[model samples]
Target: MTTASSVSRGRSGWGSTAVAVLLVAVMLFPVYWMLNVSLQPGGGGAVASPWLPLHPDVSGYAKALRDQGPHLLTSLVVSLGSVVVSLVLATPAAYALAQFRLRFTDAFLLGILVSQMVPGIVVANALYGVYSDLGLLNSLPGLVLADSSTGIPFAVLVLRAFMATVPGEVVEAARVDGAGELRTFWSVVVPMSRNALVTAGLFTFLFTWSDFLFALTLTTTDDVRPVTLGLYQYIGSYVQDWSAVMATAVLASLPAVVLLLVAQKYVAAGATAGALK
Candidate 1:
């Protein structure tokens, strides 16, 4: 009976592992197909499609890099700027909301949640008029500020949730040692919540990186075009360059993929930090 039970448990573990692999493959198939399509030779009319690129071509990547490199740099700058602004603004707000029992705290949290429901186009349209009046419609600073709106509220919510889990005793001990609120926050809370901060900052980076709506709506000229807008040019009214489009998409997706791989450790640590405490 013992031998039979051991065999059954081993089979169950193998079955679970197989299902996990199948799920991962299903989720990754589109990425695989995009890469495959990007390597196909560019020609007129509908080119033949295949599961794999038997004869891979680099011309699409060459064209993509040549045309979209500036736009990709613009995206990187805007994304990094937005991360700085979001974390600086959201961290203090989150700490206050999580620690202080203010009367309007719930209302503020509600407003943040409701802001997510508002259409991006509506916000863009509103900002367009404001930006036009302020002479910021076709500028890098404008785009960074606009993209930051996407990260700020979400960062506030995420950081607030994590801050709520911090032990009050830890904060009080910092105060007892003669540290003021700001000092305590900077010295104590911030270090304790490093994993959570990293996780929030990682997501803020990605949110601003992948933003297309503000990039499309806020900027009227090519001076501040993001890679997403650059990708749109490959699909014109009459001609569609599928290989170049796929190539641009593959390049645009790299930051998100890289950020996820790098920051996933911090995210796991943050999630488990609460349980450990």
Candidate 2:
């Protein structure tokens, strides 16, 4: 009976593994196709074979490099700046909401939720006039601030949930040691919530990096263009450059791919641990 049960369990585990593998393949099909198209010879994405790149060409990548390199750097700068701003503002606000129990905490959180519900286009339209007046249009700082709108509320929600799980006794112990609230938060709470902070920062980076709407509306000239807009411009009104477009897309996707691979463990932990209690 023991041997029979062992054999059954082994079969079940193998079956589950097969299902997981199939699911991953299904999810990765688009990425595989993008790579395939990028590697094809300059035929505007119309390759003779779909399965493999029989004639790989590097000219597309060369063109993309020449055209989109500055845009990619601009994206990196804005994304990093947005992450910094979001974390700086959200960390303290999240801690307050998690620990302070102020009378308007619920209202404040509700406001955040409402902000998320507002459409991105609406926000962009509203900010355009403000940015024009402030002379922030077509600038990196303007893009950073606009992108932070996408990150800050989500970070606050995630960080607050995780921060709430921090042991009350631990915080009390730090206070008893004569640590002021700010010092305690900086030294103890921040260290304890490192995983959540990393996870929040990762998401913030991705959000800002992938942002196209704000980049489109906020920047008027090529002086401050991001990779997303640069990629969009590859398809002109008369003709489309599919090879260069796909190459640029692949290059743009690299940061997100690398980030997920590097910080996936922290992401999973934060998602599980930050479950609303």
Candidate 3:
């Protein structure tokens, strides 16, 4: 009986492993195809095999980087800038919401959550008008502001939940030592919530980096246009260069992938901590 049971368990384990491998392959096929197409050398109306590149070349990457001009750089700048600005502004606000009991605090928090429900496209026309009126159209700062409006609420909510997990005793002790609110927050609360902060920043970075609608509608020139818009430009009305499009797509996805890989541990920890608390 024991031997029979062991054999059955072994077969079950093998079956599970096979299924897992198949699932992974299915998920990864699209990414493989994207890379394959990106490396292929062919223009529109050129029939190229999808599985393998007929003429593998780096011209697509070169075009994406060089001929594409400062758009990639502009995207990097806007994404990084928006994340930093949102984190800086959101952290203290979150800390306040988490730690203090202000009048209408609940209402304020609700308002922030409600703002996220408003679709970006619905407000694009109004925002464009506002940007034009303020001379902020086609401006980096304006783009940052537009992205931040969406980013700040989530940042605030996530960091606030993380901040709530911190022991109030630690904060009280800091205040007893004559530390002011800012000092206590800087030295005490900030350090304890580093994992949460990193998680929030990573989330903000990914959202701002991937944003296309806002970036396209708000900015007019290549100077402020993000890689999303730049990639869109490759697809013309009459024809589309699939290879270059795939190459740009791969390149645009790299930063978010790297950021997630690096910060995954913190993200997990922050999530677990928030849930347990």
Candidate 4:
């Protein structure tokens, strides 16, 4: 009945909401600024862009599409290829690590964890010599393989966590029906773990899509450039078209943003399902 303590709690709750909103606004400000700049006429000509795009323009986007279209396609191919490779390799590995009592399983998992701690530059340098020897430099296949290095490990961990929670009795029941391990996995486990697969696949796509390091390291030609590395066109001693740069960035960000928004439910389900494991 409007007690003093209830009133105080209500005010505190609103205070927390206000603070959260403020924090979100602060973090999202740069994204808003990027959008504003992308819409401005010629990026407002070296002056700070105004808070809003009172006069929106599309020329920058047109130019960006003209110049970066191939790069965007290349990135799409590489990111999709990396997702396929990562899932194909990681799913079995994760299943084995999750279910099998193999020797060195824990040690192998530890090794994978340690691999994540290694610096990307070190891995890139190591791959550089190998790729040069193998004549893989500037090749799309080389970039796909290189980007999958990051995707595989992460996919394995996520998939393993979810697979670990899969009921052993379900697998056993499949075996009782004369289903081979591979068949059982495909027929039973895969369908049940769709959320985890989506989660892993989307993340792999994001990783490979944004992978500037591998693209820069493995590619030396314009023929196979991904959009992340192609962003270099906007930067140089002679560059002055900030609008083009911002437009390119905005375009580059679209796929990941769209994927996250679309698959957010699957991602959340996969994450919470894996928590106990």
RMSD of 2: 2.3
Cα TM-score of candidate 3? 0.92
lDDT of 2 by residue, 1-277 (tens): 9999999999999999999999999999888887877776665644443688777887778888988999999999999999999999999999999989799999999999999999999999999999999999999999999999999999999899999999899999999999999999999999988889889999999999989999999999999998988888765621355677778889999999999999999998887787745
Candidate 3 achieves a global lDDT of 0.83
Q: Which regions of candidate 2 are displaced past 4 Å?
A: 1-20, 47-50, 237-240
Better of 2 and 4 by TM-score: 4
- Indicate which candidate wins on TM-score: 4
Model 1 ranges with Cα > 4 A deviation: 1-19, 44-47, 237-240, 271-277
Give every collision pair in model 4: none
Which has the better TM-score: candidate 2, or candidate 3? Answer: 3
C-alpha local distance difference test of each model: 0.86, 0.89, 0.83, 0.89
What would the per-residue lDDT of candidate 3 be over residues 79-168, giving only the tens digit for each residue? Answer: 888889998999999999989988988999899888888888987778999999999999999888888877889889989888988889
Shift in Å, residue 204, candidate 1: 1.3
Q: What does candidate 4's lDDT look like per residue over 45-118, in tens digits?
A: 43477778888998888988998899999999999999999999999999999989999998999999999999
Q: Going through the candidates in order, what is the number of backbone clashes in each?
A: 0, 0, 0, 0
Residue 74 CA displacement from its true place in model 4, Å:
1.0
Cα error of candidate 2 at position 144, Å:
0.2
Shift in Å, residue 275, candidate 4: 2.0
